[model samples]
Target chain A: DAGITQSPRYKITETGRQVTLMCHQTWSHSYMFWYRQDLGHGLRLIYYSAAADITDKGEVPDGYVVSRSKTENFPLTLESATRSQTSVYFCASSEQGRETQYFGPGTRLLVL
Target chain B: DQQVKQNSPSLSVQEGRISILNCDYTNSMFDYFLWYKKYPAEGPTFLISISSIKDKNEDGRFTVFLNKSAKHLSLHIVPSQPGDSAVYFCAADRYNSGGYQKVTFGTGTKLQVIP
Candidate 1:
């Protein structure tokens, strides 16, 4: 597809384990972001990448790690997953500085 | 603190009626606002937006009104239809510390239309 896509639409992992959520965009956008959506918290930014190899923390980046080695891909890794990390993860891409973000289908992760 | 707030959790309206969804912001630094609609299992789609300079922006059945002084904005849908049933989100864009545009989104409001 030409738009952004997230791998493992649904995932189940145990606490203390490591998990990585993948995001790939075909538009070659310069900005890629990772957000987690929960019941009360709409969409809190976990991490954002301005360009390849340039990533920064977002609102809720405590337990999440993100890296962008290519313009088309931005993956989020949970070093040590916890129950608090169980939420729907969304990946989005924009042209440069947050003009408009196009989001992926989302990855539903459950921690046991 | 939540910069963007959507107080209504859900709203129900009859077809062909007016549907109004309101949003409030605590930060005056936000210069841009946008509304997005999302369905289950799908990503949110852009609905309408209004810049701080403009008070109102309309597109088809969707219209967005911005009140800078009150730090409030609203999305109004006229002659609402059943197809408009979905979750609507309000977002604000502010200049972050690093000079990048930062977006903060509201919890979202679910609208149900009865035909």
Candidate 2:
């Protein structure tokens, strides 16, 4: 519980279904981020939170939603999962702006 | 548009040789750069980082060189080891209005250090 962790390391779901990926960190970092990695797109930021109750969209945030109700937890949800959404999702946290981030083990999602 | 780009999809080098991975970025405003290494089933872990004010940074056997004019950077691992084989991603960063840094990552370059 000292490092960042992502729940449900692997998940399989059909298109149009909703799925949520959970992330928790014990470092109490003020900055948390969610990213998705694909074959040709290394790591695309989906969303980020600066602090509890303060979240903002990132480059690839069209189909995903995120919430940060607590400093230790940030969850991402796919409103309508699509085949294109199938990719490895990573959660990262940093102490402050411009600080190096520590990543979670990642969640491998498959949308059929 | 992809701001950070790693043109080489893969590279192979013999152990004890120098392994170099290149990256380029379109954005000139990026203030910081970082490299992340990822394994088959694990998420990426931070390897090295360089600030825009410096041209080079080194740690142990790893070194990162930055060229601001060319918007290019490279990571060099001397005497590469077989255990060093992994996918490398280059990322550019800048502090956003949200009081957090925003990162743009490259497609990644897979390096294979053969023994």
- For each candidate in the order shown, give its overall lDDT on alpha carbons: 0.92, 0.95
Clashing pairs in 1: none
In angstroms, the error of model 2 at B4 is 0.3
Candidate number achieving the greatest lDDT relative to the actual structure: 2
The backbone clash count of each candidate, in order, is 0, 0
Query: Can you write out model 1's per-residue Cα lDDT over A61-91, one digit (the tens) per residue?
Result: 9988888888999999999999999999999
- State in Å the error of residue B71, model 2: 0.6
- Name the runs in model 2 displaced over 4 angstroms: none
Predicted candidate 2 versus true structure: per-residue lDDT over B2-103, tens digit per residue:
999999999999999999999999988898999999999998999999999999999999999999999999999998999999999999998776556899
Model 1, backbone clash pairs (residues 3+ apart or across chains), number: 0
CAPRI grade, predicted model 1: medium
For each candidate, the DockQ is 0.76, 0.87
Cα RMSD of predicted structure 1: 0.9
